[model samples]
Target: MNWLLVVVGGMTGAPLRYLTDRAVQSRHDSVFPWGTFAVNITGCLILGALTGAALAGATGSHLQLLLGTGLCGALTTYSTFSYETLRLAETGARFYALANVAASVAAGLGAAFLGVMLARAVWG
Candidate 1:
């Protein structure tokens, strides 16, 4: 049952990530990996909210396994982020690479914190 939940979430999240990435990338001409950045931050925010709900006893382990471990695990792509950053650096876009790293980290963390706060406030 747990595994099925995870699988279902992963199935949804993986394609969602891909479709969203393509859509976002298509809309932008920049090479800053905005697609990957978007998904990762979004994932962080969602996971944070889910975690907050769990902490507040509004959710349980099954939801956690499905959304956090499965969905977010697929929705976020650390590998793609690393590859894009490394590609930027190798291609002489070191500024973009550094900016991507800094922005992604800062924004991801910020989104997560904000999500948690929002969830706690709502759930509490």
Candidate 2:
């Protein structure tokens, strides 16, 4: 079932997100939310690839549900991104907050576009 697929993917994705975040954060001592940014950008790239595969008729509803809806949904944390940005602003790191927004959006979009391009080239 679609729900089961989502659950299974989420089971894998959520912990991966956490571990990845921890790993990335451990490498950085700055207030910039590099961990969250990495995960979101990565998620966007993967989702874009999955979507491109679907569009190319290389994937099914079940794969979409499992990867796009579940894995990406859990891996990308918009709430955390928002919260961290807000915290940065509230804590007087306004420049970092703005930079985070700008960088994340730009990079995320670029990554998604690249993913789609890669998928289309490979599958189509």
Candidate 3:
């Protein structure tokens, strides 16, 4: 059952990752990987909200199974981030790669924190 949820979440998450990549890529002019940035930030916010909801005792395991295991699991992507970073490294774009690594983690975490705070304040 849990494996099934993971698979379903992956399905949604992978496509979301791809769609967001395309959407951001279409609007950005730099090779700085705005798609990745957008997706990770959004994912962070969502995960944070989920965490907040879980903590508040406002939800149940089935909800967690869907949101935590499915939605969030799909939303937060590590593989694409790794692949892009590696591509940058292999292409002699060391600085850009490092920036992506730092920015993704820092911004993602920041967004997650903000989301948690926002949900807590608003919903509670």
**Candidate 3: which pairs clash?**
none
Q: TM-score for model 1? A: 0.98
lDDT of 1: 0.95
- Candidate 1's residue-wise lDDT over 1-124, tens digit each? 9999899889989999999999999999898999999999999999989988988999999999899989999999999999999999999999999999999999999999988998999997
Q: Which stretches of candidate 1 lie over 4 Å from their true place?
A: none
What are the per-residue Cα lDDT tens digits for candidate 2 across 14-72?
Answer: 99899999999999999999999999999989988998898899999999999998899
lDDT of each: 0.95, 0.94, 0.82
Number of backbone collisions per candidate: 0, 0, 0
What candidate 3 gets wrong by more than 4 Å, as runs, is: 1-8
Residue-level lDDT tens digits of model 3 in 11-37: 888788888889998998877778987
**Better model by lDDT: candidate 2 vs candidate 3:** 2
List TM-score per model, in order.
Answer: 0.98, 0.98, 0.86
